[model samples]
Target: MRITWWGHATTTIEANGTRLLTDPVLTSRIAHLRRRRGPAPLPEAGECDAVLISHMHADHLHLTSLPLVAPDAALVVPRGAAKLIHADSGPAFSDRCIEVAPGNQVRIGSLDITTVTANHDGRRLPWSGHSGPAVGYRVEGAPSVWFAGDTDLYDELAAEAGPVDLALVPVGGWGPSLGPGHLDAVRAAEAVRRVRAKIAVPVHFGTFWPIGMDWVKPELFLPPGDKFKAAVDPEVRVELLEPGESIEVLA
Candidate 1:
């Protein structure tokens, strides 16, 4: 399977001749924050057979980037998301949105995707005018991959996700300190160990940040991913990709 990190929580996974996009936040600027790094590859949502909405957070479920995918692509979103997507972004999303909850499965062409529970608040910021459930995905095909969308360490995660070839785990956020229901590099490394994935990719770091706060402590934005990789068990290989970079893994 081929995996590409597109900054923040967004990723593109290709397996079984099908492309799956996860939490696509392709815009250069989202609300008050401007992407400090170069934008992700042009036309960010490219030829995806399905798109996974991990949660309703703007950084994860940016509606602006949704249209980049093919209109026919199936959208695998959390339960109660359809209404919220329509209410927040309008009815244009109704055509292909498929609402799913933990343990639910959806098939897109040759791939079978199963939703998994996430230990995080799923509600979209009421002020943002969007809301939806939070969840993760376990995709099975030529190469099974687990995308643990923005979640903290939870006891049931190892048993729920099972073994997979690759795991995409979030290690940081766009803030100086992580709050309840979020994972720091140490916690994310522990989560990777629990899942027992053959290969792990650290994401959700080194992306957008609040303007004018760069002086407070810039290391917070750049080092968490590498720190996580260094702390994790060496048995599992780790790949840290810059935005727009791709990695191929054989399980």
Candidate 2:
């Protein structure tokens, strides 16, 4: 299996001749923030086979970047997302969208994808009037991969995800202050231990940040991945890849 980190929560997992992209944010930057380090170049959406949206957050389920995926490509989004995607912007929005709830599974090419529950706010904002449940995904192929989306530690996570060869976890966010429904470095490391994946990749950090906050500690933007690696058990190999870098793991 080959995993490529595009940036933030975005990643492309290739296995069995299929490419699955998770939470794509193709823009060079988002809101007032910019990608300061990692991945001089970002991958285009057309390069993927299917797109998985973990939630309705602007960064995760970006409407502007949705067009990058091929029109024929299947779009797996959180349950009730179709109502939100179509009602707000007419039927033109997400024409290929497929709604999925936890435990729901879909077969695309050689991959079998199963949606898993996520513990995060899944609202489309009042202006959009589109709301849905947040979710994670367990993609099974030659080597199974789990994308945890944006979620805090939950007791049922391991059972829900089953056994995955690679686990992609969120360790930080855009800001230093982490609210509920998010995971810090320590918590993420603990999650890695619980899931017991053969390989772990830390994401959701060192991407976007609020403008004019340069005075704040810069390390806050860049240290979560390393911290999680240090805290997690050494037996579980951690691959800290720069954005846009790809790593191949044999099953």
- Evaluate model 1: give its TM-score: 0.95
Model 2 lDDT per residue over 51-119, tens place:
899999888987767766666678899977777667654576557788898989998778999999888
Q: What is the lDDT of residue 197 in candidate 2?
A: 86
Question: Per-residue lDDT of 71-111 in model 1, one digit per residue for the tens?
Answer: 77888898877777787667777657999999899998778
lDDT of 1 at 167: 87
Top-lDDT structure, candidate number: 1
Best model number under TM-score: 1
Show the lowest summed lDDT stretch of 10 residues, model 2.
37-46
Quote the RMSD, in angstroms, for model 1: 1.5
Model 2 TM-score relative to the real fold:
0.93
